[model samples]
Target chain A: MVITPQRNIVSRTWGTSVGKKSVIAVTGIVFLLYVIAHMIGNLKVFFGIETFDAYSQHLREIGEAIFGYEGVLWGIRAVLVGSVVLHMWAAFSLWYQAKKARPIGYQHRQRWEGSYAARTMRWGGVIIALFVIWHILDLTTGTVNPLGGDESAYLKLVASFDRWYVALFYILAVVALGLHIRHGLWSAIQTFGANSALKQNALKTFAFVVAAVITIGFAIVPLSVMTGLVR
Target chain B: MKLTLRIWRQASPEAKGKMQKYTLDDVEPDMSFLEMLDVLNEKLVLDDKDPVSFDHDCREGICGSCGMVINGNAHGPQKFTTTCQLHMRHFNDGDTIDIEPWRAKAFPVVKDLVVDRSAFDEIIKSGGYISVNTGSAPEAHAIPVDKVSADDAFDAATCIGCGACVAACPNGSSMLFTAAKVTHLGLLPQGQPERATRAINMLATQDELDFGGCTNVGACHEVCPKGIPLASIAQLNHDVLGATLTGARSD
Candidate 1:
């Protein structure tokens, strides 16, 4: 029952809601940048298998002169893993705190305002989490990918998306991700104190545009594969 | 005007409450919402029944004491109006108004339509003050403040410590209320010394309490009687960030 402030500044910040929201905002920006970069990389598939495969190889070969082979990729992987962990931790703790705050429900509750995206943030987050796990297994590990671990990266991607069901799942996950990003970006901006009265509309529009582009950008790869355009 | 009322009735904090319906006749449209309640209580007293209990003080809407969820809206259906100031005219003839207490774990029901809002006091007690020595009053222009900042600070200072923000929020967050206090002081030169400390301590106190985390749904400002802007919350975030980054703990 005795609650004392943590010794470290970081841990102390974690003890407050504002601190948790800051974590969510910062980590969200990291994910946002990663997704944009990922979408651009995925678009290389349109240039044929050589360009796509070479692009994949180039990612691993980044910082080769200084960090040695695969060192930069591993570094990026480490950062991404850290970001995901912090993001999920902050999100879950906030959700738990919110649930604990309202032990009783109103007999007649109404959400006349607030965006649909904001309302569904929790469930959208859950869907995205599940999707990320499935995505890593399918593409990164080649465990769930139909092409197995023997095929090239391009071939594995093509093999997986060539199936209608797999492509459908990817599309659905991407849609959920779009909704998450839409609300998360807006919320993050507000949390970081970047929003103002004059800039509110602009920020909202930017959120929608980013969400739409990322969703459609990611969706195109699987869709092209299924439609025989990438073959 | 005639109306039907479905008011939440709870005997104690642990009692299981439910909606008890009542029919009110000879209701006047010009009567304030609280006056209608008073009439209802008189009838209940005449019938030898326990009259409903609710909070009210300075019924002119200055004091934040009066608050209730009327027809699913905090402080009644009218925008930017307190329960006491809300008139029966807003309700149509024969309308059925559903009244409930402010629902939040931090503010438990003391009785029907009355909750213990001392959690707000704890948040204020944490840092909502200036450490000024008691002596002769200082000169009016001892410390000059800019017009904009002063105005903004004044706006934030209008917060009445009402729990309506928490009651209306889907998450039951007190961010708007806490943010108003933080911004009001943080903007002033006097509040500069403890700016970072105030942010950290007050936010920590809020976390320790049962109040929820803010998701920036922007519902709090809508239901707020004083129309406290969401910008105050943005200011709160700015201060908290600075405090955390600098490790500014008063202790």
Candidate 2:
């Protein structure tokens, strides 16, 4: 069969940096929302192992009445995977575009402009990507988890945190994620054309608060587990 | 005053460029940066050597024709000053200044200190103008623009198309230059008809020309000779988003 040349809207738009930026902004917000929800869900450990285990089981049973078991969970997973792929694609393309813009390097340069978060975006993204892979292996696949898949969700969490290195790594990853979210949120809003001189301070504050809350919220889980507070 | 210059010398656009050293004595402190270069060029001419070629139209700052990365800073260390307007008094005796052209792929070097900035012109040609039927000059009072908006428009309009913003940008972004034009037009009544289309078209051209994305570095504002504020870029973003969402057409 002959393949037809079809011009998709995405292909047409993604040809430009502005279009790529729009993709990045939309996908970034998706990841931000997911992280916030994940943090809250993880916090169920504070209510006891039954509550946390029930919460984990509830995620798998979502939409079971209509679509059968694990259907809604798969749906959520699909969306998240799509978002991550799109986000990474846009980010890499943008980075390439930036590199192409300046073919030569400066003999002497100074970082007189840009924010700390803005400067660290590339490295922070790398850290987060590495953390994501390690996290899935340890928790979801039970490959590196000390308690293994046979144990309860609460027990696995405690077991992983009891290893000091694992908890420290988790804390570091969350901190990097926090920095990424802090800059990403403000940049996304600006990209979407939601910023102005009058609203600059308020928007910045909102970005900082959201990032801090999510990071601290996630960090508290591993810390509590390691301290035996949750165990 | 005495000074040492490490100037980039490239024979042509395709030629390999390198830093060439030169020492100048009795350089008056009152001489402008461009004037200092002129003295050096004069010396080269007297010595029967090929003088350094740099672009300059009006020696004044309004033309935006003259620019060089002086000592790693666009237009030198003086804030909001053009290369032609920078005075040598800012430097002391025995200072070594490194001079190089803008190092963006979008701006290919023409010679020693000049780069092709026709990309900026193409961006303007895309959609930086409004349609008008020529008849007679309209009265100034005919259009009643609010003072705040009129001032803001004037401020944005002051951008001289100087590539300093791009040169100073870490990513080599032309957002400030494009945004100045977009925001200037978007704020006016006459520009309202093409506001949406102008934003979309100009930004599209800018991207096509291979300018980097703006990460809100604020470098463009810092190095702008006209002191164009970063707010203009925000307005440009606002306009582009509105145009894209509303599916505005250029026709």
Candidate 3:
């Protein structure tokens, strides 16, 4: 195809806007896959504190051992932190841009015709972001957790879930994460350019299943702890 | 039926525009929306007032020239129907309708409801076409395409390049529109030669126009005159990514 200078300028600028979605979609898929993996990992809690704590400790021991310190877990955490920041930044930027593009208000109220997954993405994203911060502070950093009262990771987890609010927050966050993942998964595939309707619908259905697994799998941990099944 | 319309009016590309109210009485319910506007324009012309400027050629809806925000929807409330095909019966007597041009920074208002949608043309120009051979027409049946694939491609090809998807998008995302075209040509046998580069360059053009990202709002599909599915957007994304990764360079 023949390319002109004016066309070049137009593509260079306009293409950048559409191009950002590609990055967002790619990174979102990475985060969602990580979520699925994390949910499966969290399922260790049901096997009892020994298995869960051992698994957590094992994760903590995996990168570079600095002066006899195994920095593997820290390295993984760093990578995860970077992914989280990138995902959130991309999401917020798109959100801000979308907000600016809309008219102040519709002359007549526009009814939303989108699916539940797409509709709640923004809200679900916000809740998940907040939950991540709380989760890291409570478990990873041991900063504000009630159960970390004695620095016993297993006991801390058990005690934390004992609280109705803490348990509820975790459950609620997982649900929100579920919604975010369900939409994000297929959307990421769309961004990646999956064109076949059969493939698209399959991805959508697969995303729903993943979301269900994450929601139920993560919930199992807290629910088990709350009900004394883990004890 | 009688209805009040707040139509956007602008004298030139540089002129600031706003919604100006006009009342049309005894409007036939069977009249197309644009026809109703035409009736209103005749009244304005008779009154020695400048008629509202818009674009239209083929009134049958294939041309995609007519598009306006009707009560906050592009191409009005009907699904898979263009503005010219929209009937006035959708509105009730005494209804106050707000009509405006398709809003997008890339699609600047040329005059009144007629915005310069040339940005789409530019995007397509960037890489939308196939580099087919120049020779006698090939037998249509020569390309042994799977019926399912052919059907899907045809559906994507139905997109008329009306800026409705962008206009209806909260982010002004043109993903659906762009994707429809890219997927339409990309899925076909004829499009294979330029497929990789086409996806890349076309996407580059899409972003350059200051269009917003697709958050999968599905509004584009909802407002699409041809009912272009959101799946095409996904297809576009997939093709772009594949193109970008494979380093498919077109000579």
Candidate 4:
């Protein structure tokens, strides 16, 4: 790529917010879709340990085991990773600039009475990131104890959720994820140009419900395990 | 009504900005937002303080000059009014209102609530105008334009370039503003000759400008005083992608 001084200087300068926001919105949509797909894949855990592990193994053992090629799933992962990077970079850059614009606080009673969703977006994101890190470690690494009971990979999941606090933390994280996703999803659609009042309201409501379902669905398993509803 | 105002104060572009609070007692609810600011400035001048600076031109809604993020929303709480047209009646007595410039990388603070939006001008300069040879003005009736197409184009053309869309957007994307202009010209019969080229140039320029990519957030259309449709953005994306695919093969 040709790099003129003006182009290089302009690139370093803070670009327009509208432009950045659009990128954020589009990348956000891609990330959300990936999360939803991931959540659905995890739903395979509900059936039984054999079924859950088999499902996961099937994902890895695709093509050679069944279809004779692992093409589509790898492609999907590649797209998901690309979208995640773009989404994270855009979000981080926008946040940094917003912070840069203000150096000091005003002596007014700050009130964000009307916009709870927008205000919590950043925090929600943090909570989700932490949760993802923990989740990956718990499921993939075996570094954390699933609980005090079984050390077996499958048994760890069931055993770990037995603790009320740990299970509750998952539940809360899921709730935050729902709230994050609800606001994020609807906001992305709006950013992309779906601006009718009726449509906006409808999508906003739909996002709220979808996020709620995904969050609750994932959270329920841990709670069920803690209560001995699922052993 | 007595209103407490928290306005951003910055000495210069490099100086760190802060929100300075002041009280305006007996503020008339009927006064426009700018008029209320004027009252505050008069008081500041009396105290030997420099008057607060903000952008304003043709206080009517038509001019795109006046814009500020008031209490988290662009152009304040009122639905369609620009900051200049926003009235104090919408606020409560003794209510402290927070005000700040449109926060974005592309828009730097020149002064309190006055941002340098020249980035927008640069984007426009890149390919926003139709290049035509100098000649007599074309007859209005010579080129027949469908009323609906003309109206849609006019509606898209109503973008005031206030940069509110960027401020409201989560990622600070300018897709809506740039897309609106692209669609406005691309919709017309006269614009067809340069439509493909215009899309490629404008889209590429928009990316080159370091503006964030379109995330499809509808905040731009929501806060737009001109009510620019978000559909135009989708159309612009489609056209840009299509143009890119067909325009040429340049490695």
Candidate 5:
């Protein structure tokens, strides 16, 4: 395939504010869906070690006949990684633009009294990104898992959460992720052009509830383990 | 009412601006904000001092020329009101108000309380002109429009290009202004042929002019003089994506 060197419509728009934001909106939805799914899978730990461990192994076995061993799992990982790269790229680009546009701020720049979640979107995103790395090391790859990679998924989770510091960190990261979602979900709704006067209230409520649900769902596991409810 | 006013003073575009204080007595509650400024200017004239320079054209709030940050909020504390129409009644007797130019890199200060806003014109020009045949006036009923779109277009057409949205936005974004134009034209039958290119060029130019990226802070919507809704930005975003997917060519 010969790629034309000349600037085309696609290339021009891709570097623009609309282009970058559209990208963020699309990738953000992917993460949103993935987190909800991951939370539901984690809740399976309540069903006992056997069922939870079975679920973890089942992720690798999905579509075994058609895609071969671990193919579907790898595919999911590929999409997630791609989403992360695009999401961060667009987010940083927007951040740089915003910073450049307002070199001189107001002497008494009255805060718009925006939601705390909206105000902390950038820093919250950074915290969430860092947490993703730690989470992958501890749970997915088991490189830092105290119980080791060879142990059952349930045991690995329990062992990681059994440490008070690890559990506290998990709760902190979960809250940051939730706040990120609270702002991001509504921003995505606007970017997609689905927001309007009539639907604004309902959609705002929906975004808040979804963010709250995801935060609680993830945080509960670490709390349960620390409290000895899931040991 | 006696009030202390802290106004930004910049002699030239290259000069370092600073806040200077002035005491304004005999400020009547019925006097418009600009009228109060006139009283202050008269006092300066008698003192043989250079008067404070600000932008104002139509004091009735129709013209887009008058805009400044009053006490950190764009167009002062009133809702759906312009600085030209903001009366003195809103302020307390002894209130100390801070007045400054719109502080965005895209909008540079020209003098005291006045900033260069031609960047908005550049963004408007890049959107390209509508293709209308030059001839006698066409019949009114020749091209019919539905009521909903017509009303929506009119609602968007109310934008006066005052730059209040930029002053109000945390990101210094001009999306609301660009969105108003795109939505006004996009909703009409005459705007169809160039709709895609309009969205692409206008948005691209807005970015090129060094305006900030919009994060949907909702401040712009709240402080808008004409009450332009945040949904107009959504509509503009919708048009942009729709245009891109169709492989529309740009100039």
Candidate 6:
């Protein structure tokens, strides 16, 4: 209440391109945490359907001793939803600003820098967003899931991926997620944790490794189901 | 060496421009890229034709007065080399080269190869000048700076306000140029008092000028003549984040 003047300044700061990027960077960390935990949880299916089902049920029951049923899961969902909204808002604003900055085209333009991952970040983000909606519907809500309502997360994953096309689509989206993380994670570091130039190489390598590990971690589940390994 | 040059020719700031082809017969490998242009200009002037105009002052690279896109890369094809310092030796005989101006909304083409880069100056003005004890130089060792910070400060200070970074960026963002100035001063003790405001105001001015937002593409650093690293831009982001969360304001 006393900081209304400061609030105006903070809001105005977010209105700037630099401040908008800050929002993207912070929200990016949120997604990173969520996906990593989700990937690790997905690994429980390897121990068989019963173990995977227990893990899925356990996620909702986390911190229930203090906060009551599904409290922690709801809190996580709220933060994740908030993060996705802010991330897209900032990303779109920056995208528009970037487009408007160069109305005139160079007759002799050439690709001089950036990784393949960096260049495809915008498109990859879009792919991942679409996949997230499909993913939530299939597994979380079980609405369009082949196993349909009340199925556990493991059975939904198995039923969906049993079809070759679903497995293929899931793999495609996971690859896109990997590419997005390969560049986005390092970029987020540059925004929030930038300290010195000496650590750049190490940081970049770390980003790439994390991205690759997470992609493989998520992809294996669908691959196992498609190949009848998890059936 | 002989070469074919496709150069953009614009008469004025508001005029439409087109690429005109020219040939240079006696271009020596030892000659600087700008000197080769000089030879071409000499023949054009003698022929009563309008010569190709480009910006250059110090034939040496440090002045930052000269810049042009040669075959798409800002400051020519070489890494860490300014256009004036780029020599003809790198090219093959009878090679074709394309020359153009720094293209960006903030840095509009002033003529053939010169873009008005006053937007950079506006960003600098927002940073404001650092106040120092000016009556006499303070004791030599009075303000001790760590080796790493001092080295980085010097690295950031080396940005010559050249628009090469802006020209090279895919989005035409001036983040590198603005970051250079911000880090150059912010790293020093003299720059402490205004640090918060400097970060906020400079970025605000940058947005006001309609320059693009940096996407961390690393194109600017790739073509930077000074080799101003991407770390500077990261530092700029860091400062702005700190400023925003702490409720810092220019006023």
Maximum-TM-score candidate: 5
lDDT of 1 at A21: 92
In the range A1-231, model 5's lDDT, one tens digit per residue, is: 111221565564566787788899999999999999999999999999999999999998999999998999899899999999999988898999999998988987665636889888888898899999999999988999997778899999999998899999999999999999998999999998899867888988999999999999999999999888999
Q: Which of the predicted structures, 1 or 2, would earn the higher DockQ when compared with the native? A: 1
Against the true structure, what is each candidate's TM-score? Answer: 0.94, 0.92, 0.86, 0.74, 0.95, 0.94
Evaluate all candidate structures by whole-model CA lDDT and list the values in order: 0.89, 0.86, 0.78, 0.72, 0.89, 0.86
Tens digits of per-residue lDDT for model 5, B1-251: 99999999999999998999999989999999999999999999999998999999989898989988998898999999999999999999999999999989999999999999999999889773587989998998999999989998899999999999998787889999999999999989999988887887788788888998989878888888999988889988988887767666554
Q: i-RMS values of the candidates, in order? A: 2.1, 5.2, 5.0, 7.6, 4.4, 4.0
- Residue B82 lDDT (model 6): 92
Worst 10 residues of 1 chain B by lDDT: B242-251
Q: What's the TM-score, to 2 decimals, of chain B in model 1?
A: 0.99
Global lDDT for candidate 5? 0.89
DockQ per candidate, 2 decimals: 0.57, 0.37, 0.38, 0.14, 0.50, 0.49
Model 1 CA lDDT for position A145? 92
What lDDT tens digits, residue by residue, belong to model 2 across residues A34-131? 89889989999899989999999999898899979999988988998998898889888888878899998777675355778778887789889999
Compute the lDDT of residue A53 as modeled in candidate 3: 79
Give candidate 6's TM-score. 0.94
lDDT of 4 by residue, B38-67 (tens): 999999999999999999999998889999
For candidate 6 chain A, which ten residues in a row score worst on lDDT? Answer: A1-10
lDDT of 4: 0.72
| Candidate 2 docking band | acceptable
| Clashing residue pairs, backbone N/CA/C < 3 A, model 1 | none
Better of 4 and 5 by lDDT: 5
Clash numbers, per candidate: 0, 0, 20, 35, 0, 0
Q: Tell me the lDDT of model 4 at A184.
A: 81
